[model samples]
Target: MLLTVKIGKKTEKLKLNRKEKILKILKKLGLNRENVVCKLNGKIVTEEEYVGTKDKLEIIIIVSGD
Candidate 1:
């Protein structure tokens, strides 16, 4: 299965198995799941959400400032 992930100005295509969760994919990509907000098909989703084969994912890295 192919999952499309967009992070800021960059976009990535990732290969995931059936029933794969968002958190696992992030780990594979070397991203910190705790610091990123995930959206699936335009809706905000948790890391435990299951990803479909053709799901489009958007990853937003949260930035904090003083």
Candidate 2:
């Protein structure tokens, strides 16, 4: 299964197993799940959300300002 992940100006295509969680996919990409906001198919989704083969994921990094 291939999932499209778009982060800022960069986009990546990842090969994932069936029913893989968003968190696991982030881990595979070496990204911290806690610092990123995930949106699946234009809707915000939780880390526990399972991604399908044709799903499109938009990842936005959450930044904290002091």
Candidate 3:
């Protein structure tokens, strides 16, 4: 399954063999789950959310300020 991922300003096309957790997907992309938010098909989803092929995933980086 091929998943389309958009992180910040970059877009990536990932090939996945099966459904997996959002956290694992983040790790595959060398991303920290704690520092980003996952959105599936325009809907906010948790790290535990299962994603598969033909899914549109958006990774939003969390920013902090003093």
Clashes of 3: 0
Error of 3 at 7 (Å): 0.5
Residues 24-53 of candidate 2: C-alpha lDDT, one tens digit per residue? 888988889889999999999898998887
What TM-score does candidate 1 get on C-alpha atoms? Answer: 0.86
What tens digits encode model 3's per-residue C-alpha lDDT throughout 1-66?
Answer: 688899999999988989988999899999998899999999999999998887889999998767
The lDDT leader among the candidates is 3
Predicted candidate 2, C-alpha RMSD:
1.4
Clash pairs, model 1 backbone: none
lDDT of 1: 0.86
Error of 1 at 11 (Å): 0.6
Candidate 3 lDDT trough over 10 residues, lowest sum: 48-57
- Best-matching candidate per TM-score: 3
Q: How many residue pairs clash in each candidate?
A: 0, 0, 0
